[model samples]
Target: MNRTLTERARSMRIHSGLPKQFWAEAVNTTSYLINRGPSVPLKHRIPEEVWIGKEVNLSWLKVFGCIAYVHIRVFKYKNGSNSVLVVKKDDYDKCNTEKPIMKMDDGDSVFKFDRSGPFFFISGNKDNSQKDQKLIVVVLAIRNHNKFPPVAVPPAPVGQTPASSPSPTKSSPSPAPATTPSPISHTTSATSLSPI
Candidate 1:
């Protein structure tokens, strides 16, 4: 049994193209597979099935060295009044009017973060009109451990009133409250958007 395990482990490691450092994992996987496979000495019965008196679940099994991805679901506030754009670091720094990585027309779209990186969000109108542009820059830094920095809201856009503008003498009608939607889930590849 020991010789069989050693040989199977070596074969598995070589087939998977894994480094020698993964010998322990290879050995473990070999032992698991051996237990789940039919044994000639046991009348072609599976060892684990005989021991547990039940069939083992193999639905979750995957290739030993295959690439994997993570699924992410992001919940964004519903704001139909303005258009939101997600741009790369260089584009945001230069304020270039080129095509953005993502554009939220209805403001309720989901953005998946499949890997560790930074995402820059700027809210404004769809058109390039200066008057309709209300730049609200927000930076969301996602790391390997899922740590996120405090959301930083940049200063107001040029030629715009500062946040400390005085209140109007006459009362104005309050805008409609924004609604929150249910969480949406998706799976996507990692993007190259990261902080400078």
Candidate 2:
């Protein structure tokens, strides 16, 4: 997410011809700093110049890059501090611990999900028998929208339909050829017709 955001910021600055200090100030939120690249200026440098307007909006702000505590309902035995995993992807699924619909962690939450792909994570699975921590490593595929769309396919070439389909029946005939008379003959015919 930070990488993508940084790339976007770079492009935004380039297109706008704005200085890096402007972006640095606008994206100076503590959370934003944590998630963004090291090249971005420090929080002190971020100022009003980078903001869309005179002031930045904090109401819509969220924790930058954070280690989210995954809720494990299936296997509750395994638990540790180092269990923190960098979120590789986020899909708004009700089943995943970080599902938008589901509850949120008390503290900061950094969910990393590809802009266009399912979310997945690999960790130790919680074991039923063992006393050690058993973490579940699996990929939770969730649909962003409620509807499940069918796979799309490109159309075939023109004049050719499906294999089971029949060919075209008939088409209109070509137009007849036009006849152009010589200039001399046309003038002579006109002159003779007028006189006689």
Off by more than 4 A, model 1: 70-196
| Best by the TM-score measure | 1
State the lDDT of candidate 2 residue by residue for 61-128, as single tens digits: 54322223443332222344222222334321112333223222323334434332223432322231
TM-score of each: 0.36, 0.15
Query: What local lDDT score does residue 194 receive in model 1, on the 0 to 100 scale?
Result: 12
Winning model by lDDT: 1
* Tens digits of lDDT, candidate 1, 1-196: 9878887877766556555556676678889999999999999999999999998888899766454454343435557666667777665555544678877766566666554334655554435424434243222222133223555568889999776876777788789799865244334332311111
Each model's lDDT: 0.61, 0.37
Candidate 2 Cα lDDT to native: 0.37
